[model samples]
Target: MKEIIAIIVFCLALIKGEINSEILIVSENNCHQVFDKDQGQITSLGYPTFSSSNSSCTYVIKAKKGQVISLQWKDFNLPAGHDRLCHGSSDSVVVYDGRQIGINNLYTPMCGNHSFDITSSGNMMTVVLSSTSDEFDIMSFYRGFKAAYKSMSHHCKNMIYKTGYGAIASPHFPMAYPANLDCVYTIKLNQDRVMLLEFAEFALKPVKGNNNKMAMDDCDDYVEVYEGAISQRNRYFRHCGYYKPHPITTGGNIVHIKLHSAKSQLALYTGFRAFYYSGVPNKCGLFYGTPSGALTIPVIPQTSGINVECQFTIKSPQVAYYRVRWLSFGQDLFKKGCDENNYIEIYNGFYDKKDKLLAKKCDTKLDEFDTQYNEMLVRFKIEKFNPSRNFKFIYIGVTNNTVKVITDKNQTCTAKTTIVYRYSGPEVISREVKCELFSIGGLPFWASLLIVCGAGGGGLGAISVAFCLIRRRIRARRRYRRFERSDSEGSL
Candidate 1:
């Protein structure tokens, strides 16, 4: 009879799908997911309801460190053929594990639909989205250009590039050139030569190159056509140089400059303006630039504790390439692990300089940057600077407005940039004034005060509290010891 009963129980266990499990997790709705610890196979857990509504319920789990967690849900509801409730069906819950860090779904995965796995397995313990596109995160990639371009170009016969920031709706709006320069222009990468250029009131004839060639007047406006290898002496400049030069030609249009990086890291930067010899100051300190003919714009001192920011419009008719490089001079300035390269090279979006051909690259996303250092040089270049086909550079990554370039990056660092004109034309070069890092946390003042106060009141309040707690603990321990001794003696 006992054997028969055991057999019946075994059959019931099989019917209920109850197998010995290994790992467990508490779900947002208090449902439990069971799987083998070794194999990581989900034995049984019915369909999960993914909620995106802000006021959805939460589930709590009691677990230890080093446990793997996952969520199961879908992006859409009713399999695409059902009803009027399709709007809020894709909202999901993102679980933040208190202990070990790993991927957590912002929403549950759709049935049978894969690839939306957002993993975050870092010690930082932050539930940062690893999957699903983050348009804002791309901006951080461009901070590498903090040491490249200097100031506005003095040969501003017709073109001006200025940095502007604030709350704005569209990516291309809110862009304004420096007020000091006369002619202001916006370059867009488009199929039809649609570019914009305004003539400065005080137009000066450009100095001729040594070849006695007209050195290309109004050439700065057509940076899209100049197709050649791009290079810069400043290693930390943000703009990545291209092996092939691209000049501008299309007028009233924006251009895209995509860089390819295969093996070595690429530093990309872009800015406007070039400083002349008269404005260049004789070198006095590492942080100061020489006087060049161009007026020196005083470098802004970083106001610590506040977020400093700058937003520029990247009106490329096509997709554009962006890169950033920075010079690290202060302590704690080294790249986390790489000692060989003094500067950090970060590619903001898609495209690598290492590719054998530019055709192999594609734009994954578009975004802008924020300044991150106390002082930095900036250099910005598109495929070309103009509308006439005489210059060469690809304004658009593929075609025109079908794609767009945007800047979303900002910084709290001070900046002083100088543009070097190749002779007396708008063809100006760039560099930046170095800056020193200052602390605004008031930690030094507070630390000194703490030391002084403690020295004066040494062993006073702390000792008093310590003694009281210690006595109480000791009395309790003594009473327990005495009881134990009395019991042992009485037993004897």
Candidate 2:
């Protein structure tokens, strides 16, 4: 009879839509849950209008990695205190910014009726409601809060890379980066190889308040590069504009790239795409022991940057002179001279600017240049707002007493050969001789002609003509020998 009476009382409590005070734990059916989907909704336990003392309910929201959760509250009606402040209220709803439940993770606490929205910086969020010993009127019911949550995947932050070659883009990349967005990427390579960073495309926010200019020092959006690690002192270059940036080589194996966007800029720009790879050391230094070599700008399809400079010094043996021959050359040239814009300058000594100026060339022309001293310096400089340019040249060490002979053996009756003689001493003299009429096995030309005519059966008439030609050739050869003997005696 007692058990039947208890069952009837429990049925009566359910009919009244009341929660048992002893049932303090929240079950899976009573709590709201969400996962990787787009949206979800949650309400208080026994929602739509009910009050419970000593009851607990929880709501869990989740999203994908690298995404955040956004929540919007529709209705909030907790029992208010007499002072109208929810700082120390007994009946309240607490929001945890992350999945952990702790005092430090609490985002906010609400007690009275209010509607607001908030966003979590992580992939998960938790909302908890607890009504301890009912402090308000027991006869009246209080409606709790209801909220809707959605996943947002637009936030950009930290990224890491560990490979030989990789690419990085802005927050939205092909699209415009979000306003007030700061993104950073760290790239690491093997210890023996250096890092090379090249920009395939770059279109940042242009400078404002200047009609004639397309770039400036003050930029609304910019990208910065660092050499070893990310720090203020290790910054290598900072750039902005629509022009593509030239390739940058770091000193060590690590590189850090940082991108910053201002809040005011709203125009859509395709930001930038940068590529990085491992490379050998490419910088200004002294080169020796290399007999013949070629030097040029390492990166292709390069663009404009601020006050960039590259220098190289070529040193030869003590007794030899340096000769530089250009295979290909092209750059932005000024009408008057190469003092402005992008240019390459050559000096005659070990130091670049401190030495004597040999010549400066920026136009599209192939030329040869020789240095007076044994060492030579070549420097290339680029200013703001310039097109891409490059040059290729070969350098060789030449001695004064060197003789080079070149011969072609493909001709049937005659062979052409060139001989170049370089004289030593203070006053240098060089000359080239071209010899084309020389017979094989020291045979006279007229004799060879006679043999060929005899073999072809041209009769004695050819023999008579060959005999006369042979006598004349013998006389000519004697005269040439006498002249050579006289010349040799005069030189001695």
Candidate 3:
């Protein structure tokens, strides 16, 4: 319950701050650079526009100790001729989990056009862009890739990662985890996909009794793995030993991991390290709200999932105003504000004419927006997937009488309200996000209880019809099951 509260606290935070009106493009000389700062952006030569062929760049970011790095590819584009399979593509952008590039560090080598997010296990992350003569086309152009990096000091407790595959560890691995620490890592994937986990290292405070005897069921520090929505009965296994466990596999789309430590052996046990990957993926046109969450359009390794078109309608409660927040961005091109290609629109009251435009933007700076009525229709578009998610918008239920913060800096937003792109792919994303910014005070935190949970959202209000769900973690000392042995560890 405490973890649930912490995650929602940010969703209710007042969206009050000055909005920056420009997009800063880094210079070409900044390539092959090493950053030890807390946050920054890396771009390939010319950004927000195409550059000459054969231009490549690389960047490495290192965070402070006890911290990890998070990345979001806001813009990623390549010439048409370079669109080939991962192994066959001549022009590619690769991301590594560590400071250097190698087979073990390779996360993904993207060739065509794609946008997504990544989180590093330790303190460093690497990005490299390369192209050859086969990719150079006198008649074609490419924008390369742009990404934002920030230091993540939180060990990702109660954080929801919908990117499908990534690495997770106790707050700061290799170093001893602090005492009385509790955290949860959740991986949500498409229902069709299964997941697997292989622990590279594992250690827990030993509960050695007389003669240095260890008990398997009895533990001081431990890790718990769950199959679905982290309920006591849904637990797959619990471990409190020091040896690396066998690879864990799950039969469902979502997996939950919980970690706990006592104060007795803070300096002795270094905790555990593990990597998780899944085979499934998108939430489009979906009407649901998990306090504050992002729009997750999974990167389906196939050619079909790369192209996207999504729409949503966020509405406020009877007497509240609808709101949206940002968790990431690619490039909000200030110079070429909202265009027919990429944009976002928020409306209050009637949709046809009486609607008030609360916010409007292009691939430029999007902070937060609230409506003048009890509901708002939100429309976000990108003629092509921008390679980085725009911003994770949250519905902060603000009172209707409060001072309005958003305004319609109208620039022909109405002129291009309806657009038809020249591509076809993710058509199922025509969801209506009608549950955000509304009062969900009575709703439970676990998504399993919300009706939209099936469609990848935790909702309230109308969703409260769903009473108590089967899946729930009661306390810090959640009930769990034990795996028999390493070789026999199995999926739920």
Best by lDDT: 2
Candidate 3 deviant stretches above 4 angstroms: 1-29, 36-38, 48-56, 64-66, 79-85, 100-104, 132-135, 155-157, 162-164, 188-196, 205-215, 248-253, 278-492
Per-residue alpha-carbon lDDT of candidate 2 for residues 1-492, written as tens digits (9 for 90 to 100): 665664565456666766454332446565555455778877876554545556666778888766667777888887775553365566777777667797545544567784445555457778888778544343445556777878766435666555444446676555676778788877776654555566766887766743224333477788887656576545544567665543554545677788888987776887886766455443321233343345554431233344557776766442245676665544443434466556778898776564488878756667787777557777877554332444555555554344333334532443433332221212223334445454445678766655666776775577788878999999999999999998989962
Q: lDDT order of candidates, best first?
A: 2, 3, 1
Determine the backbone clash count of candidate 3: 15
134-197 per-residue lDDT for model 1 (tens digits)? 1222111110000011112222232322211000011111121222222223222222223222
Q: For candidate 1, report its TM-score.
A: 0.18
C-alpha TM-scores of all predictions: 0.18, 0.30, 0.44
TM-score of model 3 (CA atoms): 0.44
For each candidate, what is the lDDT?
Answer: 0.24, 0.61, 0.56
Model 2 scores worst on lDDT over the 10 consecutive residues at: 419-428
Alpha carbon lDDT at 450, candidate 1: 50
TM-score of 2: 0.30
